[model samples]
Target: MSAYVVVELTVKNAVAKDLYSAAAGPIIREFGGEFIAGGAWSALAGVQGHPQGAIIRFPNRDSALGWYNSAAYQATLANRDARMTCSFRLIGN
Candidate 1:
C-alpha cells in the first residue's frame, strides 16, 4: 500500500519556510516521496486550514516514516521550528 504524508503549517517567517523546503525536499525525494501538492488552497469545507498544506506520497508507511525521521528532515524541522508550527499526518492509500 502507498502512504501519504499530509502536513499543515502556519508560517511565521517566509524566509525560514523556504529554507525548510530547501533542506527537506531532497531528503523526501531520497526516500522516494513525490510531491503531490504544496501550497495554499481554497477552503470549501467546514474546517479551515493553516496558510500552507502539503501532500507527499511515499512508496509505503516505512518509507514515509523513514523520511520523516531522517537526519535531513530533522534538521529542517529544527530550523523551521523557530519560525513555524507544523503538524503531519500519515494516511494509507
Candidate 2:
C-alpha cells in the first residue's frame, strides 16, 4: 500500500514556504516521495483536515515516515515554521 504525507498549511510568509518547498523537494524525492497535490483549497471534507494543503505519496508508510523524520528535513523545518502553521499526518491504506 501507498502512504501519503497530508500537509495543511496556513502561510504567513509565502516567500519562505516557497524557498523551503524548493529545498525540501530533493530530500523528499530521495525518500521516494512524490508530490501529488498542493495549494489553497475551497474546503476540507475529511477528518483532521484544513483549508490549504498538499499531499505527497510514498511507496510505503516507512518511507513516508523516514522522510518526515530525516535529518535533512529537520534542518529545513525552520523555514517552514517561519512561513506557515501546518498540521500534518502520515497515512496509509
lDDT of 2 by residue, 1-93 (tens): 999998998888788778988999999999999999998776646554555899999999999889889999999888888888998888895
Q: What is candidate 2's CA lDDT for residue 12?
A: 86
Q: Give the alpha carbon lDDT tens digit for every residue of 1-93 in model 1.
A: 999998898989999778878878889999999999988857787786677889999999999999989877886776878878878999995
TM of each candidate vs. truth: 0.89, 0.89
> After best superposition, candidate 2 residue 13: deviation in angstroms?
1.2
Error of 1 at 76 (Å): 2.2
User: Distance (Å) between predicted and true CA of 85, model 1?
Assistant: 1.6
lDDT (Cα, 0-100) at 28 in candidate 2: 95
Q: Candidate 2, residue 46: CA error in Å?
A: 7.4
Q: What is the lDDT of candidate 2?
A: 0.88
Clashing pairs in 1: none
- True-vs-predicted CA distance for residue 77, candidate 1, Å: 1.7
Residues forming the 10-long window of minimal summed lDDT in candidate 2: 42-51
Off by over 4 Å in 2: 44-50
Against the true structure, candidate 1 has what lDDT?
Answer: 0.87
Error of 1 at 35 (Å): 1.1
